[model samples]
Target chain A: MSLLRVDDLRVRFTTRRGPVQAVDGVGFTLERGEILGLVGESGSGKSQILFALMGLLPENATLDGTIEFTGSGPTMVFQDPMTALNPYLTIGLQIAEALPKGLDPATRRARIVELLTRLRIADPGARIDQYPHQLSGGMRQRIVIAMALAAAPDLILADEPTTALDVTVQADILDLFRAERRDHGRALLLVSHDLGVVAGLCDRVLVMYAGRIVEEAAVDDLFARPGHPYTRALLATVSSLAAGDSELATIPGAPPDLGLPIAGCAFAPRCAVRIERCIEARPAFRALGPGHRAACHLTKTPGTES
Target chain B: MTLLSLHDVSVRYRLAGGVLTAVDRVSLEIAAGETLAIVGESGCGKSSLGRAVVGLTPLAAGRMSWRGQDIATLDPAARRDLKRHIQIIFQDPLASLDPRMTVAEAVAEPLAVFEPKLSRAERSRRVAAMLDQVELPAAIADRLPHAISGGQCQRVAIARAMILGPELLVCDEAVSALDVSVQAQIVNLLQRLQRETGLSLLFISHGLSVVRHLSRRVAVLYLGRVVETGPVAEVFAAPAHPYTKALLSAVPIPDPIAERDRHRIILAGDPPSPAHPPSGCVFRTRCPDAIALCAEAEPTAMALPHGGRVSCHRYEPSGQAPAPGLFKEDPLGTN
Candidate 1:
């Protein structure tokens, strides 16, 4: 059985302007010990799905559909560690707060130190008493990861955990995630706007646009043979140091506003290979290959399969 | 001819606990119509260098000349005139813009201040033309910053900065906040503008990929010092300094095969506090190629064969090189 399965997940926010459909009919299933990447730009409803699963949405937000999990509740590693961590409390205390209840004070302290040490934090004994402000951005992020792992949860949700960190530090954090998955056999749902991060870590990938899942495929397959025009454009836009001096391909238009109702496909207006039917009817997700699906009208036609 | 030149420039800030050297002695020159990128991690003084160029931060030492004239000794009127030639665009577009002002008004403010002889109609026409250059629609000119999207707001910011017809534009993380597609558009627009107007750009960013795409020459900064400076292609292809190598290795390539197969140099521990930098060398604490000589004396900038300079004790002038197999074993492991 899948470790976690989300079906028809929808999130709506009631603002003064109107009801904004932040996430529209998103669905995916994560397997045991698999690292699934939820890739999207800002306002793609990628983070909202994680928020809905964790039951941490704001008061004005409403969620629908079903989320089924076979293991304990998933732990989250937030994007900004400075805001996620408590500035007033010491690092040890904040980590201890996430541990199981009914443990003795000494045992809890020992466990906190152990978690810090495992995360490659230098001199955990001395760092335990230090506040969040005393640590660097990378250290703070490691502490947040340590707290997320304190409960030994089967699943972890990392929402752009390394976005604010430097590339060297980001590499270290990615290594830690790889180690966690390899050693503990834990499942991870990584939500990020960077394709490099997703390509480096994820086993399977889901491309989200506006508020819907436009494409889903294995990591290699997604990059090698993308089935959707939006995914193709996104991949083409990724600037690489290894690439030659060719002009970067770009999507011409911006994402549709969430407050207004979307007609047809959300990405049709920006898609280079958009068709007539793409403007009149919403494309349904259809299987192109084994474990690969794309929601695009152009995918059905011959010679257009990317 | 060199448009702007800095000789041993240093910027210091008065802190509660003694003075902080935000930008250590750094010297470089930007030629006319050239793009020079300052690449480094946070707290590396790249931003301080950008600010120092625009006279936003006072230089504690060294000489800065613009078009053969000392900028530090410029009179108030001369400084005001200099503002017309040098402009900056910040990372956060919405935060940098005045929330109360309309897009058109913000774009026209530069012309209004610099060229008081122009009529209101002329100012409005120029603003409209600038907005069109940045590809922002004229209909949204009256809308406030809060109503526009981030990409559009950034376009508006670009229009405002370029409306002054500045010869030099200091872009500090200008495209970092936008999405990938939008980032490409802005980068393309900046490149096109530079070509058409013969503009010199002092591009500051941490992303090496973006830097490689836009800049001709690259300077790598560390702890407020220029550790390496060379042609972007040469520096990227074969970095001479250890920090530059580590930084380039750390960036995750989009190709999974390359990323999985590549050897990475993961430096241990965080950067030491700038308030209490290590003696002799600021980076000796985290440098994998450090030696006893590195702690005894700071390395001076040495010229390379490819017309670049690097500062490191590993490459000594007296033919004394560090042991070959010193760091064969990964200090952080997981190579």
Candidate 2:
């Protein structure tokens, strides 16, 4: 059975200008021990979907559809480690704040130690006394992960976990996540703008654009053959060291303004392979294969000469 | 001939505790119209090297010659004049640009710096043309930095830098802050601009991928020293340095399936403090290939049999044989 299911999730924010449809009819399910990558550009609404699922949406924002956290409540690890943890709070105290109900102080303290050790934080005894600022960026992020894991939740929703970290530090944090998911059988909903992170960590990828799921596929199939033009454009910009010889092709123009009602496809303006039907009407997502799907008029017929 | 050449250049900061050598005895050469990328994780002195080349920072040691003339000997006014031929683009556009100045005024400032006697109309025309070159709409001329999007602001920054048609452009993490999609656009723009203007670039970045895409040749720095330098294709295909191999192994590929199967060369610890780098080989502290000799003496860059250079005692012919962990099988065919 799927561990978490977000069905037809819709999130809209009311602003002075107008209502912005941030996540429009987004639906996906996460199975036990599976990692799904939510990939998109800034303001593409991937964050909003995660927020809506966590029931952390702002008062001005309205959400529709069901977010079923089947096994356990999924806790989130935020992007910026600097602001995520309280400066004054000790690492131990901060982690203990997430302990489940009915746990005594002794039990909670033990839980904190176990989590800190499990996350491979050096010197859990001395480290717990230190504050967030006392730790390195990578260590602080691991503390954030440990705090999230203290809940003993079935799943983790990490939003750009390694975006602010250095390359080597990023590699370490990713290794931690992979290790945790493998050992504990914890499912993950990894949201990030870096294609490399998604490519290395995720089992399935759901490409979001202008608040809708534009494409979804298994990682291997998507990388091997991308049916959607947007996905292809995104892959070209990865700056692969091995694939350094090929010239890059960038998707021109900025993403569409969600405040203004989007007519036709959201990626129509920037898509290089746009058809006449793209600008006139919205494209419904069609199942291309067992797990592959794309919301594009051109990609409707696989390998078709559009 | 090399357009810009540095001979054992070093920079140090006079801190309260002691002298901090930010850039240490770094020697490099940039040929005309070539993109030479200096890449490493933060604090490796890539930015300091860029600053030293452009004379933003004081050179503690060595000599920097630009087109056969020593830059350090130039007068303050002449140094300002030198900016016309070599301009710099900082990492953050929002921080670099003056919040008070409009987009036009910012781009025009460089023009005024280079040609103070030019008429206002001519200056505005030049600024407009530069903006056009970067593909920014003319309507943004009146907008302040905060009013425009991040991508547009970066374009304005690039336009401002290129208004004088500088021969050498030093970009320090220019597109690192932008979204992946936006990063590609700016990189493509820079490539086209370089092609048309034949501008040489000193691109400083921590991102290996960006360096691979934008650089004709690559230099890997560690602890304020160059560990490897060579053509991008040759070096990336078969990196001779252990540091370079570890760095290459860490780049996250876009496809998850391939990523699952690939072996990552995970370094055990954070890089040693640059303030007090390890004795002998700077990388010996964390290097898997470290031997007794590695900790006793520093390694110098030696030309590899394969096209490129590497700084490692193991790779040095005078040194001992290559250790088991010292060398990696080339993922990219050496041939």
Candidate 3:
């Protein structure tokens, strides 16, 4: 069985101005032990999908979707380690509480230390007694991951876990995830705006834009052959050391507001190769290859034309 | 000519129990129209250094001189004038901007403070023109920051920072919070403005790719101290410091083939706390090439054969660093 399945997911919020269709329609699946990436810009609804599944939306929000994960309650690693962790609680108690109940105090302590060591936290013994406020941002982030993994859940849902973190720290976090997948074979649904993180860590990717999945493919195929213009534009902006005097290729306009009604393709306004049909009609998500799909008129036929 | 010079600058913050020195003794210079990137892991003091330059944080020690004058000790009138010449764009535009104020009002406040003599009509016109330069539509001038998009709000922030035609701009993780496409837009806008205005830029960011694309020179910081500083091309091509090599290799490149083949120099353990920084060298706790001298005494900044400087015992005479060619070539290929 697939690790998780999400179908026709929709999320909306009742704002003072109007109703915001935060997530129009998003659908994807996660196989066992798979690392699937949800890539999008802010307000593109990538993070919303995770929130929708976690059922953590506010009173003003309404969700319509099916998140089928039969194993157990999935764990979540939110963005911003500073705010995600509680300031008042000690790291040991927080992580220990996440463990299965009925364990002896010694086992709980040992398990917490093991989890901390897995996150590459030095002095786990002493750190267990410390509070969240005492650790650095990097160590705190690792603590956040440890808390998430404490339950030994089969699936992990992370939202922008590595965004804005330094390269060394980010690499360490990525390494931990890779090790988890290798040693335990736990499935992960990672959301991030950084293309580098997705390119390096994810096995498959789902490109989201304005509350919809614009493209989906295996990691290699997506990077090698991006089908959607939005994906191509996003990939082009991934600056490299070799970029010399050349201007970064930016998408012309901003993402459409989710509050107002979006007619037809949400990305039509900013797309470089958008056709007349793109502005008038929403394109169907069609298969471009065995495991690749994109919701673009140009990509409908696939390899035929740009 | 050097537009700004910082000598042994340090920024310290006082906590309840102790004094936390965020930025250690660091010195550097920026030429007019040049972009210098400050990069490091979190808590490495890149932001502190940037904040100190823009006067947001007071210097605990050392001097930041602009045009041969100490910025911190300048006269009140001179300081106010200096504010016009030096502007800053923070990381979060939405948080930085006043929620109650419209885009035009927020961008116009700087002009009102510095050039109060301008008529309302002239002020509005200049605001509109600045918006156009940042590529934000004039129609949204009356809209609140919440009503506009994040990318648009960032454009407004850039517009406000550039309205004074400042000689130097400090971008403190300016585009780090934005989406990739939006980040690219702001990066391009900043580059375009720099080209048009010839303004010196102190670009503080952890995003290496953006740094590589924007900066002429780059400084790698570790535990509030600079481990390496050099020309962008030379540093990335052949990093002299072990910290620099690890930092460059740590960044994930957006290429699948390379990702599979590349040998990442993954640093172990979390970064050491700045409050209890290791004795002798700040980076000695994590430096892969640390020798006995690294733990016994501090290594001063030494000029490299390339156009940069590095602080590492490996470069000193009689120093023995066991690891040689320990790092694999960066998969991004420093071409």
Candidate 4:
């Protein structure tokens, strides 16, 4: 069985303006041991989908979807490690809580220390007793990862796990994720705003905008020949040290407010190569190649797909 | 010509633990029309240096000069005038702006402080013009900061900063909080303003890619010190310091093929506390190329072949000849 599957997931929140559809008609499948990446801007509903899956959304949110997970329950790692952990708990105790109930005290402590050491926390013995405030940001993040992994589940969901960290420290945490996936055959669904990070780590990429998946492909294909205009713009405008002082191209205007229902294409207003049909009707997912698809009317069929 | 110069500047904080040197003995110069980016990991003091340059934080030591005039020695009137030329925009646009104030009031506050003699009509006209310059709609001037989007709030912040025609602007992670497309818009806006005004920028940020895109010169900081500083292209192409090379390698390229093909230099251990850094080199604890000499004595800045300077034992003018470029000899290496 697939590790997780969702069909026609929709999330709406009752707001003073109106009902905001945070995630609309989103559907995807994650096979066992597959690292999938979900990327989008602030209101793209990437994080909302994670919340819906974990059943952690607020009271105002009204969700209509079917999520089928084969595991007991999937664990999640939030963006901020400082808040994810309790301030009153010691680092070791928090991680130990994730383990099976009634685990021998010595064994639990040893396993917790081992996880910390694996994540490259120095002197795990001394750090196991330290409070979350005593540790630095990077170290605290490692401890959070350790806590998330203490249960040793098959799938992990990470939402911008390294966004608050420094670039150098982010590298270490990403390397740790790579090691975890490789060594234990663990699947991870990572949501982040950083395309660069998704490129390096994720096997498959999903570009979300306006609460819908615009494009889906293998990481290389997504980066190489993005069929959706939004994905293409995102890849083009990424600043690089090697890219000289050429004027950076930008998508003009802001994302559509979800309070009001969107008509046809959500990106048509800002899309440079939008077609007349884009406003008349919404585009369905078209298979561009093997395991690659995009929801854009402009994407030519079969001929351009490598 | 050097528009602003900082000589051996230092910033220290008295905390419960001990005195923390947030910025250490850092000397830098920004030309009249140049953008100089100071990049480092968190707690490496990039923001502190920016804060010091704009007088947001009191300096523990060293001096600053504008157009060769000592800023510290200036009388009250001259100091107030100098303040008009240098302005700072912070990372969080909403936090930097007053929540209660309408966009117009926030942008006009600077003018109210410096040019109070101006008639209300003239100030209102200038505020409207500034908003237009930042591409914000005139209608947004009356809205509270929360009513607009984060991108719009940032545009409002930019409007406020540029209202006074400041010559020197210190942008401390100004675009880091925005989304990708919005960040691009703000970057383009900053670029347009720089060309129009010849504004010098002390662009302090941890994001290397944006720094490279905006700044002509770049400085790499490690534990409150400049490990390397040079022209952006030169330093990025051939970094002379170990920390610089590792930092550059850590930033993942958006291209999948490039990322997979590139070899990464993942440094070990979390960043050490700045209160009591390592004895010799603050970065040696995590540096991959640390040698015995690194622990004994600190390395001084040495000139590079590409009009840059780096502090490392390998680049010691004696025999080692800088291993920063050596590790990157492999093909298609991002480092």
Candidate 5:
């Protein structure tokens, strides 16, 4: 059995304006030691899915889904370490609080230092006693990761963990994540808007748009051959270092407003290969290859009638 | 002609314990209608340099000249005129713009300040034309900044910056907050505006890809110092400094094949504090090729063969030069 399975996850937020369907029937599964990347622009419900899975959504948000896990519940590493960490509390106390109850003071201190040291934080002994403000952004992020890993949860959910960091620091943080996955054999669900980050680290990828998974494939396969128009456009729009002085291909229109009712396909308006039928009926996921599927009217999946 | 030039410009902040040097003796020149990018990580003084260029942050030492005139010696009247010629666009467009004001009012305020003699009707006409130039719909003119999308607000900000016909625009992470597609749109728009108006741009950003895409020349910053500065293609293709090479290698290429095969130069530790920066070289503490001399004395900026300047012990005459392969072969190979 898979380590974790999210079946038909739907999340809606009740606001004064109306009911906003943040995540509309998104579903995926993760195996042990797998790094699954969720790629999308903002408001595409990528973070919402992770929130729902972690049971950390706001009171106004309602979720309907079954998140099955075979081991301990997942712990999350947030995007902004500055805000995620408590300013008033010392780093040692913050990390100690994440540990289980009944641990003695000395034992807790040792564990905190160990966690920090394992994350490659320089001079963990002195750093543990310092407050969040005393450390740099990169060091604070490493502390956040240490807190998340304190429980040693089977699954880790990182939502744009390196988005706020500089590229150099970001590369270091990514290396830490890769190490965590390889060393601990833990499953990770990484949510990010950066396609380069996803392509570099993820074992598999799921492209999200308008609160739904538009496509799913192995990372290498997805980058090499994107089946969905939205996925292809997203890949092309990324300004790679290799692409020199070339006019970037952009998806012309913005994402649909979630508060409004979406009919047929949510990405159809922005999809270049969108057909008339795409405006009338929502396309279902069809298998293109083993462990690969895409929801698009233009793509001809084998054994599926057009 | 050189539109703006900085000679050993330095900016320092008075912190609690001691003084913090944000920008340390940085010098570069931006020509008319040229885009020069200052690329660095956070706390590398790129934004500080941008603010200093526009006179937001006071310079502690050195001189700045605008069109061959000393900015420091400029009288109040001349300084005010200089402000009109140089404008800055911030990272957060919504935060930079007034929330209560409509888009039209925001774009027209600059004209109201600089060209008060113009009639209201002419001002409104100019506002509409500027909005049209930025490609924002006319309907959004009356809407508040919060009602519009981030991309649209950025266009409005651009319109506001360009309304005064400024020769130099200091964009401090202007498009960093936008999505990739929107970022591309804004970058293209800036390029088009630069081409049409002959405007010079000092594009300050942490994103190397965007910097490479938009700027003609690039300057790499490390802990408030300019480690390398040259033509965008030259600096990117063959970075002479160790810090620049590490920064280039750190950025993950979107292409899987390239990203997987590329060798990364991962630095060991975080950037040192600017308040009590290391003696001699700011980056030598984290630099992989640091020598004993690098700790004793700072390396002065030396001219490179390909046209640019690099400040590194390895490039100095007495110091051994890095392997030819390290300076010539491009890490992100030609596609």
Candidate 6:
């Protein structure tokens, strides 16, 4: 059985302008010990979907469909290390707070230290006494991760966990998360705008756009053969240090306005190899290969798969 | 001949207790119309060097010459005139661009300040032309910064910067704040502008990938010093300095399978404080290659066989090489 199942999850905000359909009929399943990458541009409803699933959205937000955690509720780790943890609370106290209701203080503190030490947090004993402001950005993030893991939750939702960190620190953080996930057998939902981070951490990727899943594939397969035009555009858009001074060809147009209700494909306007059929109607996500599916009108036929 | 040259240019800020050497004696030269990226981690003085070139920060010592003219010696009026030829695009578009001004007004402000004789219609026409060059919609001219996305705001910033047709564009972490897709859009746009205008770009960024995409030449800075500088291809293909190699290895590629087996040159400690850098090499404190002599004297920036410059004592074999037991006694802690 899947550890978590999100079915037709639609999130909307009742703005003064109109109801903004942020996550439009998005669906995905996470297996135990699996790392699922939710990749997309800003305003693609990536963070919004995670927020909705965690039940942490703003007061005005309204959610539809189902977010089923077959196990326990998924604990979340935010991107910004400084902002996520309370400035007033010590690392130990914040981590201890994650302990289930009515847990003895001694047991909770012991578990906090154990988690911190395993994560290779420096001066585990002394660090427990330090507030969020006392630690480095990377250390603060580790503290947050430690807190999230204190519950021993069935799943972890990391929203751009390393974006605020330096490159070297980002690598260490990824290593820490990977190690923890493997040891604990907890599923991970990694939401990041950087495809590179997704590539490193995720087992399977679900590419989101305009609050919809445009493509879903195993990481290796996705990089090797991206079926969707939007996916192709996104990959080509990345500037690599290995590919020096080479012009990164970008998707020409901008992302569609979420405010305007769309009848056709959300990425149709920006897609370079878009077709007439793409404009008239939205395409269904059809299975292309093992654990690979793409939502595009162009890839409907067997011969059209790329 | 080099378009701009910095001979041991150092900048220091006077703090309450002591002096902060933000940019150490850094010497580099930018060839005509070449994009030279100054890449480094945070607090590495990459931004400070860019700021120094624009005369925003007073230099403590050394010389900075632009087109054979001593920029430091230029009068205030002449320095004011220099602003017309050298433009800068900041990292955060929202922060850099004025909230009150419309897109057109923001683009026109450069011309309004520099070339005051141009009429409102002429300025408007120029702004529209610049917007077209950046591929921004003409309708966005009337909109405020809040109305547009980060990518569009960046285009407006670029358009404003390029409207005056500056020879050198100092992009300080310009695309770091943007999303991957948006980053690509902005990077491509910047490259296109560079080609069309033949603008010499001093692209400053912590991201090596973006630097490799835009820069013909690259310089890696650390604690206010240029540790390594070379052609982008050579630097990325195989970096000489340990810091450069570690930095290159640190970039996460978008592939889970590849990431699992990736070889990372993970440095143990955080960057040392720049305020009172360690004796000898600034990187000696954290360098895996540090030897005995590294702490005794600073390594000179020397040219390598591959045509790159690295300021590591190990790279300079002829110099007083550090003996063994260098880092054994004083190994830096990760914390």
**DockQ metric for all predictions:** 0.51, 0.53, 0.63, 0.63, 0.62, 0.44
Cα distance off (Å), candidate 4, residue B246? 0.6
Give candidate 2 regions above 4 Å deviation. A101-110, A239-242, A301-306, B14-17, B306-308, B316-335
- For residues A1-306, what per-residue lDDT tens digits would candidate 3 score against the true structure? 787988989999999889999899788889878899998877888888888878888899989978788665589998899898889999998898789999999999999999998888889999999998888788888888998899887888999897746677888888888888899988889998877788889999999999999999999989988899998888777742234436667778777878888778999999989889999899988778979999988775655655
DockQ-superior candidate, 1 or 4 = 4
Q: Stretches of candidate 4 above 4 Å error?
A: A239-242, A303-306, B316-335
Rank by DockQ, highest first.
3, 4, 5, 2, 1, 6
Predicted structure with the largest TM-score when compared to the true one: 5
Which tens-of-lDDT digit does each residue in A190-240 have in candidate 4?
999998899899999989999999999999999888889999888777732
Give the true-structure RMSD of model 2: 3.2
Model 6 Cα lDDT, one tens digit per residue, A175-230: 88788778878889999988888888888999998899999999998888888988
Over the stretch B1-335, how does candidate 2's per-residue lDDT look in tens digits? 68888999999988887888889999888888999999998778889998887778989999988888888788898778777888888888999999999999999987776799999998888888888999999999999999888899899999988888888999999989998878877888888999999999999998777777788789999989999999876677667788887888787766666577666777766676677888999988878888999989898779876556888987754453332211123332223
Clash numbers, per candidate: 0, 2, 0, 0, 0, 4
| 1 versus 2: better DockQ goes to | 2
Identify the leading candidate in terms of DockQ.
3
True contact recovery of candidate 4: 0.79
Cα displacement (Å) at residue A157, model 1? 0.6
Put down candidate 6 lDDT per residue, B1-335, tens digits, no spaces.
67789999999999998999999999888877889999888788988899988777889999988788888788999778778778888899998889999999999998988999998888888988999999999999999999999999999999999998888889999999987767887887888887888888999998766776677789999999999988776666657788887787788766566567667876775676687788999988878889999999998877876677888888743552322111111111111
Which is the better candidate, 3 or 6, if ranked by lDDT? 3
In TM-score terms, candidate 3 sits at 0.93
The alpha-carbon interface RMSD of model 1 comes to 6.6
Candidate order (lDDT): 5, 1, 4, 3, 2, 6
* Interface RMSD, candidates in the order listed: 6.6, 3.0, 2.7, 3.5, 2.4, 7.9
Model 2 per-residue lDDT tens digits across residues A1-306 = 689888889999999988999998898899999999999999989999889878899999999988877877689999999899999999999998888778887887788888988887778989888999878788889999998888878899999999888787799999888887899899899999988788888889999998999999998888887878888888866633235444465667888888888879999998888888899999988777889999999775556455
lDDT for position B316 in model 2? 50
- Candidates 2 and 6 compared by lDDT, better number: 2
Query: Local error of candidate 5 at B99, Å?
Result: 0.5
User: Tens-digit lDDT track for model 1 on B1-335?
Assistant: 89999999999988998988878999999999999999999888999999988878989999999998888789999888888889899999999999999999999988888898998888888998999998889999999999999999998888998998999999999999888888888888899899889999999999778887888899999989999999887677667788888898887778676567667888989987767778877788889989898898988999987788999988644443321111222111112
